[model samples]
Target: MQYRFDVQGMTCGHCERAVRQALVQVDPNAQVQIDRAQGRVDVTSDAPQDTLARAIAEEGYQVAAAA
Candidate 1:
């Protein structure tokens, strides 16, 4: 499955990396693409959207909503 979301509080490359790492921790094989300027993240994984969102939140980002 694939998931897309708009995230807030990502200001730089480090933030992008943090989000990607947080998602990967939930599903190591998942593909995560983040665009910090756009506050977007696209993830391909079997994990549910909520699970992924929680992971991102744990990393100190706010997931505004799924897109």
Candidate 2:
């Protein structure tokens, strides 16, 4: 499944990586894209969105509801 999140407080490469790492931790093969300018992250994974979102949150980033 593909999930899009409107993230808050993502400002740089590290922030993007943080979110990516989190998602990968859940679904190692998961694909992630971050739009720093728009404060959003897009993820595609077979795993559940809740699982993905929790991982992202555990990495210390805010994962907003999909817009």
Candidate 3:
């Protein structure tokens, strides 16, 4: 399944990388696409939505509502 959401507090490449790393750590093959300009993340994985959101948040970012 695919999940898309807004992620706030990503202001630089490092922030993006941190979010990406967290997502990947949960599902290594997951496809992660981040649109920093829009504060969004497009993730494709079989993982549960809550699980994915937690992973992203644990990386020090806030996961906004799904879009």
Question: Tens-digit lDDT track for model 3 on 1-67?
Answer: 9999799999999999999999999999899999999999999998888998999899888896575
| Clash tally, candidates in order | 0, 0, 0
Report every candidate's CA lDDT: 0.90, 0.85, 0.91
The TM-scores of all predictions, comma-separated, are 0.93, 0.90, 0.94
How much is 21 displaced in model 2, in angstroms?
0.8
Instruction: Report model 2's TM-score to 2 decimal places.
Output: 0.90
Best by lDDT: 3
Question: What is candidate 1's CA lDDT for residue 25?
Answer: 92
lDDT-sorted candidate list, best first: 3, 1, 2
Clashing residue pairs in candidate 2 (N, C-alpha, C atoms within 3 angstroms): none
The 10-residue segment with the lowest total lDDT in model 1? 58-67
CA lDDT, candidate 2, residue 9: 79
What lDDT tens digits, residue by residue, belong to model 1 across residues 3-56?
899999999889998999998999999999888888999999999889999999
The parts of candidate 3 lying over 4 Å away from their true place are none
lDDT of 2 by residue, 1-67 (tens): 8899888878788888888888888999998888889987888899998888888788787886595
How far is 25's C-alpha from truth in model 1 (Å)?
0.6
Q: Runs in model 1 with CA error above 4 Å?
A: none
In model 2, what lDDT does residue 5 have? 86
